[model samples]
Structures are given as structure tokens and as C-alpha cells.
Target chain A: MKFLSNLINGISLGSVYAIIALGYTMVYGIARMLNFAHGDVIMVGAYICFFAIYSFNLNPVIGILMAVVVCTVLGVVIEKLAYKPLRQATSLAVLITAIGVSYFLQNMAQLLWSANPKVFPTIINGSIKLFGGELSISRTTIVIVLVCALIVVGLSIFVNHTKMGKAMRACSEDKEAAQLMGINVNKTISMTFAIGSALAAIAGVLMCCAYPNLQPTTGSMPGIKAFTAAVFGGIGSIPGAFIGGILLGVLEILGSAYISTELKDAIVFLALIIVLLVKPTGILGKKIHEKV
Target chain B: MAAMLEVNDINVYYGSIHAIKGVSFEVNEGEIISLIGANGAGKTTTLHTISGLLKSTTGSMSFMGTDLMKTPADKIVSLGLAHVPEGRRIFQGMDVEENLDMGAFTQPKSSIKGNKEIVFEHFPRLKERRHQIAGTLSGGEQQMLAMGRAMMSNPKLLMLDEPSMGLAPILVDEIFEIIKALNKAGTTILLVEQNAQMALSIASRGYVLETGRVVLEDEAKNLLNNDSIRKAYLGG
Candidate 1:
């Protein structure tokens, strides 16, 4: 029973990681730049939701939607303002710029909302009882899992079918070739950041619901972990992010439950090392398939 | 035949290195113009400059009277210019059909299907491998895919850069035939190749680029039979 409960909680947590990891991977795929500020986007998302619901007294759903919109705009703006000019700059320059953006967001949040952790309300509080409540699943957990599934599904369809999505993939594959094909690389990049940040917002709100704390640094840990998930799954592949997140989540939870709790974080990193040692290209990373 | 593309003393640089110096050429409507040169002769650079991939330092490139310097690289395709760049720059990861779809990316969705079928007709091998990744296709097939991809846009001016870089002799002949056929079907062509003999055979007008300048420009037959041209380029 304890194992099963841990498994459920692990999935709940993994889904959140998957949502966040999707943003990291997608932004990396299109922009060819690692957006270290993605985690801070989650912080911005959480604060927006908190302010909308608590300060403005808006409906929780609308608050979440507004958070998505604001994060989307923030993401596009950040890309244009901070990243666009450095499109041709060296990777080191871009990396430092991303870190600078992350710090700027963190410090700005601290100034606006204060460093003290805000107590986020339990928007959805209920549980599904199983085995006479001995085994229980929270409604929030179920919602997070379902919503993450929807996002993954919806994103897959969009990337595989839509025109803009095709352009994104093409641009990611070959920017010069895509441009010659008449794809507006700038617009495609903006759309990619917008989508990634919107997913970040979803993960952020769901995370706040799970933890019920809205601090300026609330998004840092999850952001780092989700980035791990992306690297573990093969950074550019979408399904890799999903599977890597869930696997990492389960490993962390199971390690905590079965092994020492003090070493749970270490276990996750240890598992990532083992996976890399064996495959090096995450689970489904783009591999050199032919004898070219 | 009206001049579809006109270049006037354009200079292009790779960083501080002046790659193309005082190069001038013109392509007429429905004519095949070939730029033949040795390695490092600015053949690819010239094609790239006209495609807006590289900007000229101090000269003019006009396609159908629109200044190419002002247009963004992505918008060059919409201006009735299709450039099949060196090494067959097809999206290697995308499938054959998806690549053709990308070729017609500027065209409306309703027209993509029809454009794709036309491309397949031009290269039956592409039809067979519509679902196969482009990287997996043979060198000859990839070259065909590149040409067919350029055809998807149905541009007024089709520019090919080293379309026969690494293909069998028979495949080279096959590719030139298609290039000739496309020209006969009313598409103007600007071909750049190191294969001077075959390139000059089919070209209506020929320009020999050496050290970033047009060393000679004349009707293809005249250049083909010229004593110095035959000595240097045709292996004497």
C-alpha cells in the first residue's frame, strides 16, 4: 500500500516535471539556446496566479488563464529583448545572458512580492478514497495528471500537424534552409517561446496547488529538475522529455520511500548519470542512424 | 528575352576576406545561364548573395526590378526566386514528401498537395520514397529531391549551386536533362557548377568566374569552342 501510494505521488510529481521539461526542450529545440530563465518563468507564473486569485478576487480558472497569457507575453518579450540580438553571438555569451535574465527575474520578484513565502490557497481540496480510504488519491493530483496528459497530447498534435508547428520543426532542423523555404524564422521562434512559457505557467499553477506556497524561489528546484528531465530524455525530443520526467519522478519517490530520504536527490542525479553512461543520447535522442 | 536578374559589380566578403570582386552577370527569361569556375572561385558565394543569404558590400542585385538588398532572406522565395543551395540543402531529417511540402511552404495549403504531386511526377524516385527521410536517399535521389523541391515554388528564376557535387556520371546526365526540360517548360535557370563541359553544353549563355571576376561571358557554343577555354576548363 505504501509503495502504491508513493507510486501515485511520484506520477503526480512527474507530470509536473514533464510539463516544465517540455518548455525547456522546445525552447532549446527552436532557439538553439538554453533558456535558463525558464524556471523563473514558472515563478512569474505562480505569482501572477496568486495575485489574480487572492488580490483581485478572480476565479481560479481565469487566474490560471491570465497567468498563461502573461507568461506567454513575458516569454516572447524576453526572447526578443534579451535573446534576439544575441542570435549570432557565441554560446558562452548567450548562456551568461540567460543566467542574467534568470537572476533579474528572481530579484524583481523579490522586490515586488517580498522574499517571504506567500501561502498559496488550496484551490482544489478533495480526495478519491480507495481500500476504505487506506489508499487515497487527491483530486489535485488527478487534475495535474489529467491536465499534463492533455498538454502533452495537444502539443504533439500541434507539432506534428499544424503549419506553424511544421515551420518550427523545420527552423529547428535547419534555419537557413527553412528561411529559403519562406518560413519567417523570427516569428517561429517567438511562437516557440510563447508555447514553452505557457506550459511553464501551467506547471507553475499546478505546482503551487500541490505545495500551497508562493515564494520568489518556489520555481527554482522544479525548474532545475525539469531541466534534468529534458537532458535525461534527449533535449530536443518531446517524448523524451515526457518519459524522462516520469521516470525521474518515480525514481526520486521510490528512492525516498525505499532508500534513505536524505539521499533521494542524490539518487535522481545518480540515475541520470547511469542513463547517460549507457546511452549518452537520452532514451530517444536523435542518433546517427545511417553510414553517411 | 528580358533580363530576369541583373547584377552590377557586386562585391561580397566573408568577414574581412573579399570573396567576390566586381562580379557582373545577367540571366534572361527562359534562358539557361551557367557560371562555371574552379574551387574557391566565388561560384557559391555569388548564388548565396543573390538569394539574400549573404549581402553584397557595395553593388546592386535586382530580381524582377526589386532591390534584393532590402529584402529579408526568408522573403526572397516569395519574390519568385528559388535557390537550390550547395550540398542539396534539403531538410535531412524530414521525409521526402515533407521536404517537398517545405519547398512549397510559401504557397497556400490548398495548393501544396497539387505541387507535391507535380514534383513526384518530375522525380518518380521521390514518389517512391515520399515517406523516407531525405538523408537516407541516394546522392542522385537527393539531388533530384533538391531540384524538385525548388520546382515546388514554380519560381520565375531557379538558381542551382553545385547540383552535381557528388553523383555518378549517368546521374549527372540525368540531372542536366531535367534542368534542360525545366527550361524548355518555361522556367529560367541559373546553374553554377564545376562540371564545365556538361554545364556549358546546355547553357544558352556561359560566364567563366576566376578569382572573383567574370573572365569570359559569351554564348555557350562560342565559349565551348574557344581555344583558351578548351585548354583550361576542358582538360585540353
Candidate 2:
């Protein structure tokens, strides 16, 4: 019963990481750049949600909506202002720009929100008893899991069935050919950033609700962990990110509960290193073979 | 009659290297115009420039009276112009059906089904492998997919670059036959080829390019029979 309860908590936390990893996987898949600033975007979203609900006395849903809107705009603006000009530049150059953007957002958030941590309000209260009250699952955990499932399903359908989604896949394969086919490459990439940032907003809110500690740097460690989840599942594969996140969360939780709390992160990363050594493409990544 | 496509004195540069120097040509409606040259003679560069992939420093290119120079590369396809770039750049990751869907990206959603059917009719081999991953396809089949993909947009002016580049002789003949059939169906063709004999045989008119200059221009039959052309390009 204790093991099952731990698994549920791990899954709930993993769901948040999965949501965040989706943003990292998608932006990397289409734009071919790692937006390190993705974590900072999460912080901005959380701050927005906090201000909307606590300061303005808005509803929780309205706060989430505002966070999504602000993050989406912020993601697109970041791509346009920082990344677009470096399109013809090298991968190293682009990577450096992304790191620079990450630092900029971190500093900007500190300036606006200050360094003090704010307590995140509990959006969903109460818990459900299971196994004759021996096991308990928080309402927030269930909501997070449900939301994650919905997002995964919705994204899969959109990518497989929609026109814009087809365009996105085409651009990922060959930008020049996609252009010849009349798919606007720039617009598709911008849309990717928009969707990714929107997901980041929801992730930020859920993450804070779980930990209840909000600060400018709240997004950084989670963002990096989610990035690890993306790599664990396979960098460009959506399903990979989901699977990777859940497994990472389980490992981290179980490791901390059974072993040493101080060494849980190290244990999680060590497991990743072992998995990568055996199968370098993450568990789900396809080996790229270019035909001559 | 007005030309279907016209390019006047286009000068294209690859940084410091002048790739296409003051090149000029025009394609009239319902005609197969072949540009034959050895490698690095700017045939591919010329096609890329006209399709808005590369910028030209000095040139006036128009298709059906629209200024192509100002048009963006993605918008050029909606203007009824399509280019089958060299190497048959089919999306290797996508299936055959998805590739066709991408081909008709600019067309109305209602037309995708009909366009796909037409493409299948032209190359029934593709219909057999509709679900197959494109990267695993044989070279000849990949070429067919490339041409069939270009046809999905129902282009008024279709530009083919090195369609027969790495195919067997029999497959080359088969591809040329398809080109002729496509032209017969009223799609104006601009073919660039190193296979001068095959290209000229199917084309109504031909231009012989050397070092970025059109050194010879005449009816296809005339160029095929010209002594210098037979020696230099036709390998007589």
C-alpha cells in the first residue's frame, strides 16, 4: 500500500515533468535548438498566475488562462527577437543565444518579482482514501494526471490530423522542400513555440501547487529535470518524453524514500547514463539513416 | 502568345563566386524547354533562383505576369509554379501518402483526395507503397514520388532538375516518357539535365549552357544534329 501511494505521487510529479518536457522536445524537434530559457518561461507563467489569483482576486482558472496567454506571447517574442536573427548562424551560436536568453529571463524575473519566495495557493483541496483508508491520493495529483493525459491525446491528434501539424512534420524533415510545398516554415516554427510555451504555463502552475514554493528560480531545476526526461524518452519523440518523465519521477521518489534523499538526483542521473550507454537514442529515438 | 515564364538577364552570386552570370531564357505555354549543361554550369542554381530559393542581384523573372523576384519561396508554389529539386528530396521520414499530402499543402483541402488519385494514376507504384516509409524506397520509386509529388499541386509550370541523375538507363527512359506524358497533359516543363541526348529528344527546344552562358540555342532537332553539340554534349 505504501509502495502504491508512492507510485501515485511519483506519477503526479512525473506528469508535471512530462508537460514541461513536451515543450523542450517539440522546440528541439522543429527549431533544432534547445531553448534553455524554457524554464524561465515557466517561472514567468507561475508569477503571472500568482499575481492574477492572489493580488487581483481572480479565479484559479482565469489565472491559469492568463499564465498561458502571457507565456505563449513570451515564447514567440523570445523566438523572434533572439532566435530568428540567428537562423543562418551555426548551432553553437544558436545554443549560446539560448543560454543568453535564459539568463536574461532569470534576471528579468528577479527584478520584477524579487527574490523572495511566495507560497503557492492550493487550487484543489482534499484527498481520497483508498484500500480502507490505508492509501490516500491528493486531488491535485488526480487533476495533474488527467490534464497530462488530455494534453498528450490532444497533441497526438493535432499532429496527426491537422494541416498545421502536417506542415510542422514536413519542416522538421526538410525546410527547403516544405517551403516549396507552400508551408510557411517560419510561421510553423513560431506556432511550435506558442504551443510549447502554453504547455509550460500549465506545468509551472501545477509544479508550484505541488511544492507550494514559488520563486524566480523555481523553474530552473524542474526545467532541467524535464529536459533530462525528454532525453531519457528520446529527444524528438513525444511518447518518449512522457515515458521518460514518469520513469524519472518514480526513480527519484523511490530512491529518496528507500535510499538517501541527498543522493536521489544523482541516482536518477546515474540511471539515465546507464540507459543511454545501452541504447544511445533514448528508449524511443529512431536511428537516423540518410539515403545517398 | 505571351510566354508562360520569362527570365531576363539574371545574375546570381554565391558570395564571391558568380554562379549564374546574366543568364536569360523564356518558356512559352505548352512547351518543353530543356536546359542542358555539364555539372556546375548553374542549371540547378538557375532553377533555384527562379523559384525564389536564391536571390538574384540583377534579374527580372516573371511567371504568368507575376514578378517572381519579390515573391517569397513558399508563396511561389501557390502561383502554380513547382520545382522538383535535385536528389529527389522526398521527406524520408514520412510515408508516401503523407508526402502527397505535403505536396498539396497549398491546394484546397477538398482537392487533396482528387489530386492524390491523379498522382497515383500517373505512378501506380506509389499506390502500392502508400504506407511504406519513403527512405526505404528504391531510387527509381523515390524519383517517381518526387515527380508525382510535384504534380499534386497541379502546377501550370513544372521545373525538373536532374530527374535522371542516378537512375538506370531503362528507368531514365521511363522517367522521360512520364515527362513527355505530363507535358502532353498541358503542364509546361522546364527540364535541366546532364543527359543532353535524352533531354533534347523529348524537348521541343533546347539551350546548351557552358560556364554559366547559353552558348547554343535552337530547336531540339537542330541541336541534336549540330556537329559541335554531338561532340561536346551528345558524346558522338
**Candidate 1 chain A: worst 10 consecutive residues by lDDT?**
A283-292
Q: Evaluate residue A230 in candidate 1 and report its C-alpha lDDT on the 0 to 100 scale.
A: 92
Candidate 2 CAPRI category: medium
Per-residue alpha-carbon lDDT of model 2 for A204-257, expressed as tens digits?
A: 999988899998889999898999999999998889989998898888898898
Candidate 2 RMSD to the correct structure = 1.2
Off by over 4 Å in 1: A288-292
lDDT of 1 by residue, B40-150 (tens): 999999998988888998888889989998899999998889999898878788888888888888987788888788777778999999999988999899889888888
Q: Against the native chain B, what TM-score does each candidate's chain B reach?
A: 0.98, 0.99
Stretches of candidate 2 above 4 Å error? none
Q: Global lDDT of each model?
A: 0.91, 0.92
- Cα error, residue A258 of model 2, in Å, equals 2.0
Where is the poorest 10-residue window by lDDT in model 2 chain A?
Answer: A283-292
Clashes of 1: 0
